[model samples]
Target chain A: MIEIPYNVKPRQETGLYNAKLGIWLFLASEVMLFGGLFSAYVLLRVGSPVWPPGGEAQLNIPLATINTFNLILSSWTIVKSWIALKENDFKGFKTYMGITLLCSLIFLVIKYFEYSAKLHHGIFPSTDNFYGIYFTLTGLHGLHVIGGLIVNFYLWGPGKKMWKSEPERFTNRVEVSGLYWHFVDLVWIFLFPTLYLL
Target chain B: MSSQNLEHHKSIYLKVLLALFVLTVLTVAVSFFDFGSITLAILIGLTIAFIKGFLVAGNFMHLLDEVKPIYWLLALTVVFFFVLFFMPMLWEMNLVTVE
Candidate 1:
């Protein structure tokens, strides 16, 4: 059997483990993905005569504000969970991880209500350019949140077994996942202002 | 990482979390008032959002302590991102007039 290095420390030359390097590469590409959409947003808004065309299509800012805080709180809790794992406190890790998962659900529930309200009023992606961009951007972000939730759910559930077999690797896994979660939250940090506020 | 270093980072994370929450409130509060121009409002809102992002990425994501290659990767991404963002401005200049 060929031995695969799952928990290799930082290399002497690049100073990064394999997974760390891999995640960074993945995030770099993710940056370009969101960056392209943001560029399109700028172009579309700039080309339009009236920003957010159609005066009746208003976003629910208060609900979005609550969702923003929910994501931010989740980001904090995810990190706290990672720290708990680092400190060898499995119970604390589970508690924080559970809170993080709850926040994700709260955010998605609020988003569902917001989407339904807009759709109930006959507002949708095809309604206008603003709605088009609004639905595209927020919907994509919501998908990312869902992705994070799935990974987090696994880590909080069956994935806990890895901690016993390879403790350091488990901690590293938590750290990497936490990094991705923070990135998702960071995207929303910008998205909220771009869509809801401005 | 040593326990001491972890403890220090833990404190920093807490501080960053507090800063992010405060910035969120500030962004919402500032949005309530008219800033005279939509462009100005955007500038202010994006500025706050940028600061919040910096705190989260730097502290929470541990980008501040990341290795050199990661920084290089992000720097390259930023360059391309800015190019993509500014491409529209170039089109608006009408440098190549369409007959």
Candidate 2:
């Protein structure tokens, strides 16, 4: 059975409260996951005659810039939600989380528009080396964003009872999710320049 | 730090986020002004991106408050990243046939 204690900070136990450590380890693996793809991309860029290929830059930098802003805003909303939870403001937590989730959806919508525009222009994975890596990397990142939405959904459940009573653990959960969300954004920080600007 | 101290910390986190946003825009603006070298532009942008990653990891991810062992874990993880990210590049560069 899980131990529940009141008026006390949980000690650094071996297994139960090890979620933070476990998540970090998982993110480390994720770094490797993206790292391999990025390495392949760099190798391909070195070999390709033209960087973007097919006589088209194909990346709408301005739209992507706006999406970048939306992602950053989402990160801020996540932090705000965690802060609210720490302050024991359940309503604030729910409100901020709702905004965060909305931003995530907005990001996906913008991504869909961007991808559809590319598709309409006939840019696709098999088009060339650039498009191949482009879709692979961004597509994987998009899946992560969707996964984050599912996590946020559970957190935002109306009947969720753990959040109010176990505020510390709840806040930790938010922080962990935020860590992952920030990582996705961090990857894009580098990707935007390499894929879009360069 | 008092009970209210965490609020101050949170504000600092907000400021870091704002700084990241500004730096990102700055990177985009700078991209338009061709620095005469594509490599230079990429270098500047990547440097800023690295800084942004640090802020995100150390502040938002709560790695700053983590103990020493966690830092070691992170460092070891990065060693693996360097290995995986660069080894292929090196191999590919060496294999490129000269005309």
Candidate 3:
């Protein structure tokens, strides 16, 4: 393996910048974290009774599918925001960011509707094997969405100068946050069919 | 910068975005087929999830820009996860009853 030096004089071109590399590494760890949950989900599902839980416990596939599209659209908007920031279009970045946040809010609204419906129907984490894993996994992912939204609030805050003067750093923030946001959305990509549709 | 520059790069990013969208639709469509088993559906879904993850990580997150050293680190993390998780999986698989 050829060793690439990290240190350089301020004026020199560094072969690879630190922020981009660092975010990738951070995302790798995030992958592993989600990987654990996914693997556990598979094991539980395979070992349990027929999926969607037969008789009165079946999932609402239509509701879940709608939410799935909601999240996937959010991921696209996040990428659009990142691209806008890269081009030094702060207004465009803000517009995309706003759309992303709105998509996220829409996701949560759909989720709350689904969750509340479940609760009203007497389904919950303590209900049974299937519901237990369902609530735990999706609930955990929801918490992350809330966390991502908080970060998005700051990244898109009013009068913030980061996106204009320091485009690289701004892009980094968007990219890293996008990485996390996409992972959250990606988890639902699987969760959609598994918990509800399948 | 230039609108021309934007036009030049637009198709590439749009193409990838389109791929992501198509793959998502494919995932939803595949879930409707029972495949005669839930495990098969999960396997298919997770496989797509990994592919989507790859695109998001490599392109959206810019992991592909990293030097080889970072790849090594990622390799190590993956190997560790497999070794750590699969052993328990193996044990669970051997048990006569999953419950």
lDDT of 1 by residue, B1-99 (tens): 568878888988878888888999999999998989989999999999999999989888888777789899999989988887777667787753557
Please say which candidate is ahead in DockQ: 2 or 3.
2
Q: Which stretches of candidate 1 lie over 4 Å from their true place?
A: B95-99
How well does candidate 3 reproduce the true complex, by DockQ?
0.36
Residue pairs with backbone overlap in model 2: none
Please report the candidate that would top TM-score against the real structure: 1
lDDT tens per residue, model 3, B1-76: 2466445445455666677778878887897777997568778887887787677666654455545666787798
lDDT of 3 by residue, A67-181 (tens): 7777777777887887787677778888988988998888788889888998998887887777878888888888988988889878899535764575666676687688778
Q: What is the C-alpha DockQ of each candidate?
A: 0.81, 0.56, 0.36
Model 1 TM-score on a 0 to 1 scale: 0.95
- Per DockQ, the best of the predicted structures is 1
Task: Estimate, for each residue in B1-99, the C-alpha lDDT of model 2 and write its tens digit.
Answer: 135657666878779889989988987887788789978988888887788778777777666666665677779988998988788776666854457
User: Candidate 3: which stretches are off by over 4 Å?
Assistant: A1-22, A52-57, B1-10, B37-39, B93-99
Candidate 2's docking class is medium
- Name the lDDT value of residue B29 in candidate 1: 98
How many angstroms is residue B20 displaced in model 2 relative to the true structure, after the best TM-score fit? 1.5
Q: Per-residue error at A81 for model 2, in Å?
A: 0.7
> For each predicted model, how many residue pairs clash, with residues at least 3 apart or on different chains?
0, 0, 0
RMSD (CA, angstroms), candidate 1 = 1.8
